[model samples]
Target: MRVSSLLRFRSTSLQTSIAKQQQYVPQHKPAVQDDIKRLEDFLISKPNILVLSGAGISTESGIPDYRSEGVGLYARTNHKPIQHLEFVKSSSVRKRYWARNFVGWPNFSSTQPNATHHALARFEREMRVQAVVTQNVDRLHTKAGSRNIVELHGSGYVVKCLSCEYRIDRHEFQTILATLNPAFKDAPDMIRPDGDVEIPVDYIENFHIPECPECGGNLKPEIVFFGDCVPRPRLDKIAEMVYNSDGLLVLGSSLLVFSGYRMVLQMKDLKLPVAIVNIGDTRADHLADIKISAKCGDVIPKLFDFRKTNPL
Candidate 1:
């Protein structure tokens, strides 16, 4: 079956299974303001904090995250992301990947930073936040004017030549793609969490992929794919930042991916205080000194006392 058809079938099967299963609704309890206070106190105590963020931070800006309770990509569908090996090994895989990216890039690039991003930027300015290491490839932190940032997963806005190491702006490449694949200029409007959209298998078959203008080599987005490893230099920089900071603050991440979760383990080894602010349960809840189960947009703005009265 085609990739899109397979995904749709899986989604149908999942929904049918869920509908047939007996659901148990959990009891709702009123939220405690003390949790917020504790988070505030934790931030106040740590003069230099290293913030590790994830996709959850960008959800407020209308970008879908990967692992939220009812809204994440996994929760909604069974479509898996492209692995590094597949992408590098097969031309057909490259065509399909770029085709989806071609359809999704417009909306993905146009997304603006939300309140959570602004709040983090403000914290950086106040010297409370030393640096931010984010698992997201959206570049929202940079857009929000946060200077010290480490993009654990590289940005989607950059395209690099696999052979010559030449890089070009993603937007520029998008124009090239449109010119080459005029037939695919009007692809479906379904955008995925990772800036990829769903395209029919027929569209994938006819999609024209462009080669690097410099070396006529394969071009790929400079992101860490599922089967790819994070660069050692980036890991070393993050470790240095964590070591220099007084404590670690996790914002909107479940810590499911070991790349971000390993930081929590390192902090535990160092005996540094760790504070987590996320909507759902995280893998490192037990290691956190303070866990605030709330939306980052709702709680992050309240953590700091700004002069602007209308700050939200």
Candidate 2:
């Protein structure tokens, strides 16, 4: 049989799977079979679907997101992410940030993609998805084998010289960090969503932040930090992907951040179908053609199977 024949999802089995994963399902408004059916229909109708993902998708992978209620980093703690201007302007801030990041790096770097990420990768492999545009700095999608991806906020897996634009893999940078802070212990209160931790002031005072070896300039993670704009070229690329796709499928994002929210707006402007599968109300809820309040991990893995639907 053709591989396309395996794409149809058995509704009863899918629903049963969703029901079995109730621990991961949202309590407020769990997704019904109808919602899955609609989404399945949407996927079949729109072969070249563009996925716009956010932090929620990685939460299943043990990384915290900033905005989810009660469980998110913001709700659970008073910490805020490093702002771009602050990191650029203050030496002390960078010192503190790097110290925390050094402590948290191992745990953050070890995070593996969960079912949602794997499912998205499968979608791309099956030619159902064109690309995944993620606001997350974590490269979980790529780690999960998604090749056609646009890291809208850049990635934590890369470091760059702010002055000269020289880039290096984050692993190599971490090795440099290890050499610089050989005495630093790995103790942390907890790892924050951005792969940093709340370290003691003493650690910050003693920590050595690495400068770019080639230029003696500041080294920064390639992520688009809060209060910074996404580079124009990345925006253009995402726009091109958006224009090329027949529909938009949002997974695990509240879309409160304008960077991810604007994609939904663009899809609406293009008169394309927009389907969202998230736990709570998203900024684009009113505009979405279908909004299913369910965990992406629970629902996404069941999206592809053999049950018979219109051919893509």
Candidate 3:
């Protein structure tokens, strides 16, 4: 009769259509129905819900994620990273890494947060999501309007002088890097999604790894390098929120990294239920109470409607 009523009618008709399709499915999807109810009930209860997000949440924003075959960020930025220690010890490694990052900054910073990011932002606004703990350095979760976010890894938008510890904005550092590595100017190199590049070996060997203009310390991107540990304060912040929250929601993480995997273990210790909406078997698959093998784009939007107690 009216727009609102018409929309509701269409919703009912769609449910009927889905129910009919369910009847044709070979296996009964009782679990699917149950999961939807659990999700809705949990949200309706308004328990503090903590988010543990990975790259998958940002994939829809045109930002590449890791592990989704054609959609993964790593597959695009397949260049192997030189370890922080190695870079520090070998001038060659530092020069090469920084040179590549300098060229890649524009593309990386230009990426905007996507639907899944916006959905999480909405959840926070709706008071359904209390906090976010993420492994991504892109800072998308915060960009999405998540107020309380603990970044287990460092942010890509920052670079610090190894000696001075002065954090400079990534763009400012890129200009400094460009001035120092002039050999890479107009040089042909392959660019990748994660803001990394493939370049000639000699270019790095001769390039100077500059000192901090303010403090005379060696310069480095602030991101948590492979083999580096996340600071204790960051870990404590996540633990505090998780302990207080009613449930945990993991999005798009494979959990190959220990920082994220540890959160699953923490939930186990707290006896709090963990629900995962990832595309693959993460290290926490056995730990999660509800595992949705779907993309974040699909799962997060539907979470607005799904619940735990649907009357048969």
TM-score of each: 0.85, 0.87, 0.79
What would the per-residue lDDT of candidate 3 be over residues 76-176, giving only the tens digit for each residue? 55656457688678766777777677666776677667667877878888788898888888888777777878888889988888776578888877777
| Inter-residue clash pairs, candidate 3 | 36-307, 37-307, 37-308, 37-309, 38-307, 38-308, 40-307, 65-73
Worst 10 residues of 2 by lDDT: 18-27
Encode model 2's per-residue lDDT on 123-224: one tens digit a residue.
899999999999888889989999999999999999898999699998988888888886774554445444446666777888887778889999999989
Stretch of 10 with least lDDT, candidate 3: 21-30
Computed on alpha carbons, the lDDT of every model, listed in order, comes to 0.82, 0.82, 0.72
lDDT of 3 at 201: 70
Question: Which 10 consecutive positions of candidate 1 have the poorest summed lDDT?
Answer: 20-29
TM-score of 1: 0.85
For every model in order, what is the number of clashing pairs? 0, 2, 8
Per-residue lDDT tens digits of candidate 1, residues 89-189? 99999998898788888878988887789988999998878889999999999999999999998999899988997999999999999898878746655
Greater-lDDT candidate between 1 and 3: 1
Best by TM-score: 2
Show the colliding residue pairs in model 1.
Answer: none
